[model samples]
Target: MAFFIRWLKAASFLETKTLILDASSYIGGHLFARLGTERAVATYYRNPVGNVVYFDALSMSLSEVVKKTQDITHAVILIGDTKPDSCASDIRKSHALNVESIISIIKFLKERHIKPVFTSTESVFDGIKGSYVETDEVNPILLYGRQKLEIERYLQDYTVDFTILRLSKVYGVSPGDGTIFTSWLEQIQRNETILCSYDQVYSPIYVEDVVDGIIKAIDTGAGGIFHLSGNKPYKRIEMLEMLLSIASEFILQPVNVVRCSINDFGLLEKRPLNVSMVNDKIVKAMGLVPSDARELCSGMIKKFYTNGAMEYR
Candidate 1:
């Protein structure tokens, strides 16, 4: 009986050691907090946060970081260029980090038998269709999406024991989190005219839900592609209206709303119209039911106002 208990402890310890690459990223920060510093070690290029070591995908070696951290079972790769416009403008620079460096890291981890959890984007699918599933054909419109798909394809063809989480637009509750929701709130608070796309559609999942899904994926040893998204698809105009309605309850101010096409933003590439992914795969794998987007927005506003912590910029 004592021998069995000892063996279980050893197994648990071996399985739980995870290394979070790009721990300074928004998702990485939330994940680090959830997993705690002891259970997970982190790597950052510029900002060295809690329990993180320096690792530049361009200049440094991934093996050195791996050598420093022993008995690591999983390495969540979050280091890459995620900006659509930036990727479109400078393909070579972005590809070097997004594709080349990432592939190299995957190879290193694979050689050592460490499972990799890669955070992909819903942008992999073209916007012509909504409610994308794992089996659907992907036609990424944005350069960022294509870059992500490149890695996804590499993983599918070359590696096993990898978790590809194709996430939707992830938003946080904080005011300056830089997500569309909070950024709009900041603009509205400052009485700036908000131009929202009437045709754009997506599943905007909460950061908490994304973090939960990633942690669940790692813990359960679930491999394959999964979509971590909101409960339902929402139009850009509808989402803005929902936020406006919720914000009106907390702040008494006249807000300006301008309806426009996504092209009006002057982005280097055209945005997808309906990149809303279905989270059924993750649901079946981890039983992760995402929080309602409207409810989450309402709760976030309520928390900020009720706590009296919101400062108008």
Candidate 2:
């Protein structure tokens, strides 16, 4: 009874740490839903939290974000999924078109208000010759890459207490979302053959690990651009094969998996042959280790199969 009482007290203490999430996108929504189990929180621009204020980025101006920040202990800005479409074309024009929405929040916060933390991506790197570090020069080749790079530059010039997380390929089991794993899962479930890319290689990070790393960054009040990715790199088809093997365990149906070249898809933009990131900085700074891709895909498959596709939305 004494131990139980002490444990309850410690849990209660953890519930009071307020962190405000801006933009209720993929990672933002996932973080808020997960954090609700253990932390106190608020939101601006979006209601990642059920009971918190929903600051609509479209309707609410930046001053509102500043006002809300004053009341929270920490602020996290998730920059993806803001636009309706995730395609490269929409992403490239997002910053210029959403300038009013972006400036409002910046102006609001600049008035001696709460500090903001921004999330960016490694897509900013062109993936030309080698892996990139935090201090490396950014030369993005794609539209999505360019937009993220612009946002990073804007945020760095706008605020002092900001941290930029340059993420790599993030994979998880979110309902209806077309992650690399899910795309293959969909085809496999339908008893269809999946032609995966053998040439493309990337460092895939599990979404949960990204969240944990972000939480650690928040705790330490660490600022600056940090790489959040898996420890090792895997070819695109190798990852698909791993996912197919895991799915075969619970799923009785056999999936036809085939290797194909990137040219087959005729992707709009030229993708980097190797965009594997080295997350030594974040690991060293936060003493964190990301989970392997195999484990992540297995868990994702299990969740999808158990919950069914309708639960994704």
Candidate 3:
């Protein structure tokens, strides 16, 4: 009975009280759902979904929010204007949230004895080269990437116990998930032309894989930076072609696939062409083997058909 009691105590210690900021966001929502309300606390900005508390970084500080909520051993920050065009258009506002507010939260958490898990993007790389490792030179071309890079630099200099997960493009398996694959599938179903850039290359990871990696990082008490991305690098057009090939088996309508340069997509800022990362650090640290984009696409396509596509049609 005493040995069993000791084992229960150890298990309870492993289950830390995690605070998921911006829990309404895509990644945040998935983490909250996986962790559940019993093991995690969620915060929302506008839409309060699945038992979340209000937390507007523009108005309130992390200290204020922490005071109102339960004690948290770790905080997963998912706040900021993630859109590149938006950040480029309004530099001041986006900078305030992405850099300043994020730093403030990290400082507050560190001061209050809370481990912070920040979700950064793979855009920190300049994309001149593919398959970037953790210790590679970071030169961000887009404004959004610069902002994320700034935080990463700060974490390297300031904190020792921080977990910075630099993620690639994340996609989900559900319908209307607003991921690239799902969006393309919808357009294909409608018989619309899909214009994908041939120059742009990136690693696309499954959302569940990302969630599992984050949990593993937290549970295992991982520190420093880790790249959470897909196993292989693929050009934008290559990924689209893969999707089209798989989609041919299910869809009746024939959709046009157009290949264009990355520059053809007129944006306020220029994007990196190849931001694929080498996820060896994450694999070594967390023992994570991520799913490839093709596998995820096949699963999503099968799920879409099995759930009755005629209703969607």
Clashes of each: 0, 3, 0
Per-residue C-alpha lDDT of model 2 across residues 36-70, encoded as one tens digit per residue = 73464556443343666666665665454344323
lDDT for every model?
Answer: 0.85, 0.67, 0.85
Give the better candidate number (1 or 2) by TM-score: 1
- Ranked by TM-score, the better of candidates 2 and 3 is 3
TM-score of each: 0.93, 0.78, 0.92
What digit string (tens of lDDT, one per residue) describes model 1 on residues 97-182?
99999999999887777788999999998889799999999998898999999999999999866899999999887869898788
The alpha-carbon root-mean-square deviation between model 2 and the true structure, to one decimal in Å, is 6.8
Estimate candidate 1's alpha-carbon lDDT, on a 0 to 1 scale.
Answer: 0.85
Model 3 C-alpha RMSD vs. true structure (Å) is 4.3
Per-residue lDDT value at 40 in model 2: 43
How much is 269 displaced in model 2, in angstroms?
2.5
TM-score of 2: 0.78
Best candidate (score: TM-score): 1
Q: Point out the worst 10-residue segment of candidate 1 by lDDT.
A: 1-10
